[model samples]
Target chain A: MNEIKIFSPATVANVACGFDVLGFCLDSVGDDMVIRKTDKKGIHITKINNFDLPYEAELNVAGVSALAMYDAIDVNFGFEIEIYKNIKPGSGIGSSAASAVGSVFGMNELLGKPFNKIQLTEFAIKGEALASKCEHADNLAPALFGGFTLVKSISPLQILEIPSPDDLYATIIHPQIEIKTSESRAILPKEVPLSDAIAQSANLGSLVHALHTSDYKLISNSLHDVIVEPYRSQLIPHFNEVKLAVLKAGALGTGISGSGPSIFSLSKGEETANKVKDAIEKVYSKTGIDFDIHVSKINVKGVKIIE
Target chain B: MNEIKIFSPATVANVACGFDVLGFCLDSVGDDMVIRKTDKKGIHITKINNFDLPYEAELNVAGVSALAMYDAIDVNFGFEIEIYKNIKPGSGIGSSAASAVGSVFGMNELLGKPFNKIQLTEFAIKGEALASKCEHADNLAPALFGGFTLVKSISPLQILEIPSPDDLYATIIHPQIEIKTSESRAILPKEVPLSDAIAQSANLGSLVHALHTSDYKLISNSLHDVIVEPYRSQLIPHFNEVKLAVLKAGALGTGISGSGPSIFSLSKGEETANKVKDAIEKVYSKTGIDFDIHVSKINVKGVKIIE
Candidate 1:
């Protein structure tokens, strides 16, 4: 019997020095997708909303992932998927991840949830690899377990769920700008100085420690992106201005969201988060760019299905 | 009355992926020095032991550090010094760090302990700076704090203590070979691929999480060092043979010790640690290289006064 279902959650990647090793799921914002079991053998996918997305199963990240899932389990079942694509296209907030994860979650449920989170993540990576042509587990982990996740190794993809800090608040602003992930990736240097890599690693260690200990100041001080941000900032409009404004408004730290055009800041409290949102709005308003701001705590719960 | 006292402890740097950001203190093995307060003014570091070390005060790492400490805190005090270098020179067990840390610690004691750990580390870096010409804090922090510590950052030199796993045994083998830190450092690549760096960071993060959760498998997997070790293995004679022996004897992981001719292996139990020690000795004996192996637990207590 074919069953249809949907799931969604927001995700963050390139998490400060973590680059491809770290990601977190945001329960507050995400996209939705429906997977229906079909007697048809081949998997079929349709983009209900975004015309920019491809409908072909091989070309579609979500459709390909559903197909991969069926192949892995050797189940004779097939799926027809409709992606709601609620997360705005090119938002830099892991819109693609939400769709892929949502698809995986839906397909797993339809198949009676035989595979585990690790299996689902592996299936999701096929989708991610298709989109990025690179193996990135950052988005996949959070989509599986929710909360904060550190992808320790990739050959076998060791994933560890990091405990979230209580006072962690994230304020994200989408500036209605577009920068393709591939383009942002192109600007990054192929090689980095050994000294810088060591420093970045140090900060990353401190950041992880701070998260476990709930030391907000340590987390704030450790939120530095030396390699990627330096090069990628040029592509985003008002990068420095937005960062400066957020910091001046009392954000603990600020940086590009994923590949950017979207910016996010970490704050200790709601007051500061609101202040950061207002400050960023002031800058973009002057530039006459449309933007949406979201202020929420670290999403401890990653993905869920609504009845 | 002027009394001079000095202390230094063995240190482990590159605490997992922390590369340069982490270190820890050893309790029993270290160096000690002392100085008599003299009525005369100005600095006069008159002596040094000639055990394969340069005797000149200005050129000697310990003497240069004492000079720096005196300049910063007690310009008016004069002292005649004696050093007992317990940690052998060229052991790849932070021998130079012991001298540097001992001088700063001794000078601080002579000057009524005006500086804290941070100040002491800063002073010790002056000595390390003379040797490496770079102010690296990994060795210095463990020499001062006496437990596992993450260097976190170097500019201001933030030191955070990481939770050491219980039942952790370390087997360190010194192959009686000299691999100068400077030469070993030079062998490393000036730049690494971004993918490599991220992989390293991921392992580092996983290692930390493993420590927190006490996941032995992940810790073993995460002990990999792609940046420094691959390049450095060439400098350490029989590196692969010794590593194979250690793992064959039940070590979780093994690697060259800090710019080394020495190697370290992590074992889960003391019984396995003994096996690792014997295994390492068998390999070194085959090469006809005189070697000393120490099977010790992670030293939680870093520095202490042995009256």
Candidate 2:
């Protein structure tokens, strides 16, 4: 694909109780890219001076995904792709998803946008699968459609756009600590108590209610993780301290974002969001962990090409 | 407590994923009674012809609860209590809860309403403690109040009133076949899969959403039981068949009500409710089990004195 402009946004997936079932996109923390036609039938990836990437298309996840999609549509076009990697890989903030989504989105546009958003999302999952080895829809849904999205089902493929409350604000804190997804996945227990299962279900119901009613209090209370967090939180340093500090500072709720050293807090207003961000930073500083805070409203748009 | 009247209503606890945490009352399917003053104070019990109860007060669950309440107050109010049990005992329909709640409520009123509902509920639990040796609040809350209630914590005692959608309808079917509470409790696995736990949580979230949005379709879709229903349904004859029949007949969802032998179908309107009732009856006939159907709206009003 030549002269193609593409954009992909960051996403948060495996949301606590949602595990493989929920995700949404973030507006500012993502990647932007452009592609141009080349004489060669194969592939070439050119990373911008400030960014880094693989040289061969096959070695690159996003490139492979784009190639696969273009092949399916009989688009025999040689292409040169360039990427601006705004999201860092292994950040637990859907870094790889942005790359994959951008590739498929960009290639589709170059080929006259032959597919709909859903179709592009399907192709995006193929790209993501190359890295994770599992097709998870949580990241793709949000990366494709922005806003708060619920992945109702994956087999038959269903995506529902949850009613996003206007007052919702997200505060994400990246602790600059590394906890590989593989290790995080290893720590989770295969079995859980029946009672715990019930509690989790109850919270899920409450979460949905909070979303529908815009009841921020309920939403905060409901953003708990009984299954994954208990195990994964241990891997994240100062996890409890971070959570306590955030809630104590008036954040409605705090939880590990995706899986990891990075954690997130949800607040109802700008004041609370600011307070929550300050609280998290204070705790991280005590532990001497380098971190950055991103405070923004939920991005309703998933992917957009600026060029 | 001589020359006094006590009233208690039937309750439905565990409201699906809320197991042990949620409960609510039903006005039509509860109890009404009078505990009159008597010169001889040895705790005489009488089962009014119109009401259902054990012949002896000491043997009657409600009577025992009344006696316990009196004992707690440090007064020998040796009294004669008559019960009008509107809820049939051992029907998996909160019959014992009605009696226990009735006794505590009645005695509280006789004692000048000394204890609040919370205290009264604690006293009522003594009655359940007498029967099962395990203190449970599922039945007590609904019998004490009138609508959807949640017993969030037991040790420290915390309760919350949950907002429910107005369009909710419950169609209860009681097959003559009996499934003892103790037996039903025994079959559940002590542990469950973590993934199942997560799925249950999602179902619960969906349920809360349905209630908040008054979306009958979502509520119906979300009424799935992954922990209790899977195990408990096996004990009920034609469980799968009955559920299918009810769903096919226009009910939004169907599951074993509380334990089993009693199945309740959630419907959106009266038309669907009647259809569910008839469908269950048709299934029961094939199983050769006589059954009674109670088609009712979601009970918002919990407990109140008829006198």
Candidate 3:
């Protein structure tokens, strides 16, 4: 194949109590990219459809990811890529992950799939490291493989695509704002109280079990983030307000999506999802912050060949 | 029913990464109790079994738990009880939990089951508090509900029974030593480093997913306890040596159960469990510590009434 087009989904990391370990892909939000082989022996970004993302192959996640894949290949090949970004950067959703995952996924398909999902995810992490300055697979894992994922460890990159409840809906809103991932991380304390740590551990354990057992009530109770959310929510204008409204409006759980500006609520049905979205929107509307909202199911097929 | 009999199974708490939240019961190891209704209007302990456990109704866990249940019901009915303790107290094997749970369960059966499992767990916690001097349900919840249980919150007493892979086996060895729960607990640091906290959270999230997905490799990768085990292991002889031996013996996971003079290993099959038990025994035998070991499947039926 001379060229390949792929779509990579957006993901919600930190999943409340799960912190750096849990994340899930969203169906409606993503980035689409197309990669084509070129006579040139180096990877390059030919076009970007949205936002003034960097064009330098070494800087941009898509270009850097494609470059990493190219380095892995013994066969000499070069690629030109076009990116159609839909998930916005700095929105707490996995925008950069989509670009990074899409690039490698597209390149792998064009290269006759030499690398498996884990290797591809590793390449995506290198791309993420260039952007975030620290590597994390909470977003990349689910975006690359789809559905809910747990990063068992980061050193060897043990990633597992965990089973999730079938009928769950995610209601997300990205209020127009910018909160750098580094700053969001900086606000966290260097140490957590032992009591809070134990409680957080308990909630996270239950949350993982809830996903596997399809127990919505357990999920609702386990969505609390005692460690990160209490500190990070101050960066978002209406985090707790919107979260309370969403829960009151029938969301099973709600939290800051990844790092902030975007908040998500999970529900059992489409109707409840829409209700949660409206409730969150109701709170954000008073702030007069321009926001984008998406209600989507857990994307089971993460990054896929679109054409 | 004039008389009631019950068996409340032993439990392994903490389960490595889950601290005060997670546990599962054992099939063959437990405490048994019998409660009989009397014309008198108060709870009483008429017989003693296996240990020098207090027999005062207010002092003993069995009597205390039964008393708490009798107080819950408006109708005054006296009860007499007999204890048959098989699990040794202070061995970190939920001996107190079995006694507490057995008492409440036996009384509940005698009362024609007025309370549900949650309420029974609540009464059991009260009994445990009298014995351990702190409120916890890691052991009691699993002993009450069976299989694997996760206590997400303690204040409102939120507990959920998580799915367990059917073929799992637990191999446990209880060395003859006393490590008081209070002493085992007092040694933990008041605060933990952010990195260790995050790693612990990640391991816990993966462990929960492992139990759900039947992913044995994930379970092995996640059984690490960065928060509690390092400090608590010092109180137990041959902790690290026994652990290494169990892992080397093909056990899926091994760790200190509850607070710990006892250690438990989880394996995929009966043969592996036996091998793990023998391996753990080998290390303890060198210490010249008298110990007892049992191998059993996950107890699907937790506390149950007997004829």
TM-score of 2: 0.81
lDDT of 3 by residue, B151-207 (tens): 887889888777788889999999898887778878999999887888888888888
Q: TM-scores, in order shown?
A: 0.91, 0.81, 0.96
Stretches > 4 Å off in candidate 3: B74-77
Docking class of 1: medium
Question: Which window of 10 residues has the lowest lDDT sum in candidate 1 chain A?
Answer: A1-10
lDDT of 2: 0.73
Among the numbered candidates, top DockQ falls to 3
Badly placed stretches (over 4 Å) of model 2 are A1-8, A14-18, A24-28, A33-51, A55-82, A102-121, A145-147, A160-166, A286-288, A300-307, B1-28, B33-82, B102-132, B139-167, B304-307
TM-score of chain A of each: 0.93, 0.93, 0.98
DockQ, Cα level, model 3 = 0.76
Per-residue accuracy of model 1 over B1-307 as CA lDDT, tens digit each: 3665555677767754668776666654677776666767644555655476666667777777777777775365576666777777778778778888777776666667788888888877888777777888788887777666888877767888778788888888888877777787778788998877877777777777777777777778878888888788888788888877887898988876666776878889889998999998888888988888887777776655443
lDDT score for residue A76 of model 2: 51
Predictions ranked by TM-score, top down? 3, 1, 2
- Write the number of the candidate with greater lDDT, choosing between 1 and 3: 3
Candidate 1 residue-wise lDDT, A9-53, digit = tens:
777777666676777777568777777877777678854676478
Candidate scoring better on DockQ of 1 and 2? 1
**Candidates, ranked, DockQ:** 3, 1, 2
